[model samples]
Target: MIPHDRPVMAEADIAAAAGMELHTWRRRHGSDFRARVPVVNPGERLRLYDQAQAAAFLEGRPIPPAPPAGEPHPDDLLSTDEVAAALGTDASTVRAYASTGYLPHGTELHGRRYWPRHVVQARIDAGDQRHHPERTGAGRQPGDPRNTAPRGRRTEARVQEVAAELARAEGEALPALTADELAQRYAVSRRTGERLLAAAREYLQQTGRGA
Candidate 1:
């Protein structure tokens, strides 16, 4: 029982009360929120939180009741339905894989095969990423959802900026910036800078300003 005077709770208690994993709670409610909760430690690794703040955070939120003691964590074992939804495949396919000992899991739980989350994800990652059953024919097609180009008035402005950066280097012994330098300046990847330079050169040529 918590002492009424202090009413401090640990991180584990917070997680249990919030129905979330420790990491999940930390991710969703970061340092700023943690400060609001007023987590404190007197040079110790263990953090103590104010119970009032924690209760306030969960005041209006609806959370499912925690499973009975001795049950496994919700994340420890995943149902075939969950695995199917995650992998974008049907349950039967996942079941078939599990039946053939493909899924890295142990015995079934409550009449459903429970795949170890990490193992199932590892196997899925090792396989083809574009092998979703519903997207077989459209995976490589243009206008495919995956390949849609960025659109908006900002595109032309971006292209102009890249062109200006390139033009600043014309007739100079050293270029205005290398691809890596441009990437750093614009916060884009080096490959993106290279592609932008290529497109900028084309745009300049079309505008009769070719270098």
Candidate 2:
């Protein structure tokens, strides 16, 4: 049976549960492991961990014990005031930073801003990820987890070339093939296919129709 209900576990079991190689786990958290966890059997080299505490440490969060009955617990979403406190600044300053794209991912609702505590904290730890003009979009920044593009692949030029080819072949009318068919036809990944189609649509919208 799995040791799912047992919160405190042996080192190897903890590593397996966390889906990490033992060596990697040891290397990453060696100091903390030694300091925080108890040695179940020093003679037999058995180390133990509280799964919740270990998981929090592995994820780079604070390792404090659970809050007392009356104390408030921290939430994942930090309000503008909470974020300001974390940054050693004021709420208004945080709003300005968010407006200028200097802060990490945030959402605005009912005129109040909420930042992902971990994301913003990570950025602060790495020294504020400064705003880059090329990264801003309607709702997200380039460093967002969902905003990744494949590395070392430049497809805009080729997409434009394909658009021109289709333009000449069809005479001012873009091809009707859907994104999936275009992916299969051009041997590009679905994401690249979508980009190509988007470029084609923009081209057609601005000028005449294309691929």
Q: Residue 193 in model 1: shift from native, Å? A: 56
Model 1 worst lDDT run, 10 consecutive residues: 138-147
Point to the candidate with the largest TM-score. 1
TM-score of each: 0.28, 0.26
What is the model-wide C-alpha lDDT for candidate 1?
A: 0.53
Number of backbone collisions per candidate: 0, 0
Off by over 4 Å in 2: 1-75, 128-211
All candidates: CA RMSD (Å): 18.8, 19.7
Report the C-alpha lDDT of model 1 over 61-154, residue by residue, as the tens digit.
4332322234333345555565767777655445445534455544452223556666666767787553254444522333222233344433
The local distance difference test score of model 2 is: 0.52
